[model samples]
Target: MQITTNPEGRTILVGKAIFTPDEVNQGFEQVYKDNVSRVKIPGFRPGKAPFKIFASHVGIESMKEDFTEIAARQALKEMLSGKTIRVVGNPTFEVDSFDGPLNLTIKVSFIPDYELSDPSKITIAVPKFDVTDADLNKAIDNIRGRYASMAPVDRKAKKGDFVYFKWSVITDGRASDRKKEELVEIGMEDFVKDFDKNLVGVKSGDIKIVMAEISSGQEPVEIEINIGEIKERILPNLDDDFAKTLHVENVEALKDIVKNELLEQAKDAKEEYIESMIAKALLEKTNIELPENLIESSVDDEIEKLARDLSKKNITLEMYLEKRGINEEQLRAELTPKATNQAKLDVILDDYSKENSIEASEEEVDQEIEAISNAMKDARRPALNENDEQVRKNLARIIKRRKTVGYLMGKVQLTEK
Candidate 1:
């Protein structure tokens, strides 16, 4: 095998590999052995047919195709042997010829060579976040709201009230599937075209007509609702009785628990903020060239994730972009920079982890795999095997990168505001 590299930037290596017949002929025998029992040739039983006769039955061109494919990886490996470069993502290959001397066009993308800035010399100041009264109140309200009671009122329906009504859509002259006594929180439930908002100021025993787009690409239809009653949430006071309801000693003990939880949340937020600051500062002074295929793959992943998230809300990414007065091109343009930054961050963290001798142990990987198994037990999915080397390496890479981020965050200098 002979290899020649294209003279270009180090981000990608475009090269040509040519394998001689002697190197490629080693593949046809194995292909024949593997497929001998899988194919049916007339006048001969499976695995009893002569090699030449079976090859002829399967067509020489098809056999050659399989043989060439089987040899391409070996060709690539032979080409990259003794090279100092590390591959970043999956490499691509194109078969140029299947003749006596097989020609292949290979594209190998490697991680870009970059250096990390000195952590001690870095200057990034982030605000010291503190748990405030409002934060504590919000957290406690979250706890109280979960246990709040509802009471009926004779007044008009308000934003936070639960309104029970009978509703049906009128199409042509008929009402279909009329639902009665359906409950919906005024500001919480998402109804068609602010149907809940139109319920504001509604009194009992009143009939309300709302225009809603019930069906896609159809004209608005009139939805008639017969009001029943309005109920409001009454939050319990933070007294000793309320504390007892939550199995706590008293309100003071509850506040202490809440405060401690809030402090933990605030600490996490502060570290994240400082990490973001560090990323920005380092990126400004860092110069790195990522592989084109890696960037494109990352961008595709971002768009796919966005589309998937929107799908959960019964919306398409295209519809979302159209609602925002944008197109796919505009969406991709907006996502490219974020994807680029993320790709750069991965390369940066991997390099830093290596430089600082940071790595994930086998025990750590087993713990993660065990956690994954526990989480997926209910889904009935196959559990990941801890002994799988590839899975272990991938999990190790993730853990190492996170550790690298935490290390950098620890070095960040924060000034209290």
Candidate 2:
């Protein structure tokens, strides 16, 4: 085997592997022998056919094609061994010849060459804040609200109250009969669009009409909401017994727990905000060139995921395209930006991990796997117990990436919310 590297561009590496005729013939023979037990002919039993007859029946050209594909994969794997190539996309291959001397080319893409300076020197000032007594009181109030009960009120529906209504949406004066009994939780954002604003002053037996736009650039659509009943939330009195119900000895103990919980949550939120700030700062400072092949591969993966999700709902890719009135090219173009952003993030995180020397220990990995297996068992299920070394390595890599993100969070400044 002869290997030569061709520099297509700065970020793309193309490898040309040339295999001798003897090597190609050997591969073909191996494939033929493996398939002999499965291949059937008209005049002979399954595994009793002569080699020459079977080869003639299957056709030498087809055999050569199969042999070349397998050999090319092996050659590319050999060429990529022991290299720290940040491969961002699937390899592209081309066969220059299938006979005499098999010549195959493989293209791999990676992020452009870059370096990171000392991350420890990157000082960040995190804003600090203290949890107040008022915050604790508010948290206690929220906890009481969770155990609150609702009773039908013989009055108007106000903000912070529950309203049951039958609603219908119309687009351009045409009624959309999608579903009849879709329930709307008044204050929840997942309900009707800006439902709080629409339901604030609504009274029982009152019909409130509102107009809302679905997507940006789309025209406003009218919705009719007919309230059936109104309910007011009634909370239990905050006392020592209320605290005991929460497994706390007294009101003071409950307040202390709430205060600690709030402080921890505030710290976590601050850390998250700082991590976002750092990512944006790093992305702006970095000038990395992304290969087109990487973007394309990412888009392909995204589309495949979308297809799988739709399949769960009995929808096919062609059905989605027809419903949306879009061609494959248009869909690809629309998804490119999202895919590019994901690829950029992957490159950035990988570089950051290497610079910070972030790694997951074997013990940490084993703990994670054990935790997953235990969770599965508790759910009365079985875990994926594959003995494949590659599967274990991949899981370890995922855990390490997660840990790397956590490590970066520790290095930045956090401001309490």
Candidate 3:
């Protein structure tokens, strides 16, 4: 076998591999022998058929195709045996000349080679974050709101009141759906802009006709709502009683727990913020040529994740982009920089992890896998166990990346704001 490298672009290497006829003949014979036992011929019982007869039945062209494929894969495997090419995405192959010495061309993409900025010299200043009294108070307020009680009111509905009403929307001279009981918070514009306004000051048994322009470039929807009961939410006081409801000793204890939790969250946020700063600083300082395929793959992953999230809300990515008056191309273009940065960060982190001897132990990987498997439902447990190796590697990579980020973040200087 002979190999020649041709540069396709900045990050892609096109390899032309040519194998001698003798080299591929063995593979072709092996493939033929492997399939002969399964091949059915009229005059012979499967494996009893002569090689010539089977070859004649299957056609020589098919054998040549098989030989070309096997030889091309072998060439690629040989090329990557001791090479430093960090090939990323799937490689593409083209059978150049399978008639003679099975000539094949392969295109492989790799992350570009570049040196990272001196870690010791790099310094990132991040503001010191702490949970403040106001934060704790806000958290307590949220808890109080969660434990709020609702009481029916006889007067007109006001802001922050739950207004239960029977409503029907008439679009295009026809009522869209049957009259349904709907509850809306008077102040939160969960519906059209004028919906909350129409609900406000509506007394029980009042019939209100609201012509609302919910969307642009469409006729106003005629909505008829029969007002029902109004309920005002009364928040419980943040005192010992409320604390007892939450199984806490007292309000003071609850506040302490909330403050400690918020402080821990703030610490985590601070670490993440500092790590992002370090990444940005390192990106700016270093000159790296990222593989286009890696960036494209990352962009695809982002798009898929966005699609899944939007799917949960009964929306498609196309619908979202259309609502925003953009196309898939525009979305991909917007995500390109982010994807590029992510790819660069991954490469840099991997390199840093290796250089600094940062590693995820087997126990750490096993613990992560166990946590993940436990989080999964019983139905998916078997699948998780089946993909144990892949899961371990993915978890190990995540752990190593975090360790690398933490290492860099630890080196940065923090300034309190």
Assess every candidate by TM-score: 0.69, 0.69, 0.74
Q: What local lDDT does model 2 show for residue 58?
A: 93
Reference-based TM-score, model 3: 0.74
Q: Each candidate's root-mean-square deviation in Å?
A: 6.0, 5.8, 5.1
| Backbone clashes, each candidate | 0, 0, 0
Worst 10 residues of 2 by lDDT: 116-125
Per-residue lDDT of 69-144 in model 2, one digit per residue for the tens? 7877887788778877777757788998765888999888777677653445455555665688888888888999
Clashing pairs in 1: none
Distance from true location, Cα of 48 in model 3, Å: 9.5
Off by over 4 Å in 1: 1-3, 7-10, 17-83, 98-101, 117-128, 168-181, 192-196, 208-225, 276-286, 296-341, 363-395
Cα deviation at 213, candidate 1, in Å, is 5.9
Which candidate leads the pack in TM-score? 3
Candidate 1 overall Cα lDDT vs. reference?
A: 0.83
lDDT of 3 by residue, 1-417 (tens): 999887777788888898887877777787788888898989999798887898899999888877777776887887677778788978888988876577889888887678877776876666768677889889998889897899999998889999988878876766656897888998888866666888878898998878877675456878788888889999998789889999999989999999989989998898778777888888898888877878899899889989999999999888898887889999999998888888787788889898899999998887777777777766465435635688788888889988888888766665555
Best to worst by TM-score, what's the order?
A: 3, 1, 2
Clashing pairs in 3: none
Candidate 1, after superposition: displacement of residue 229 in Å?
0.7
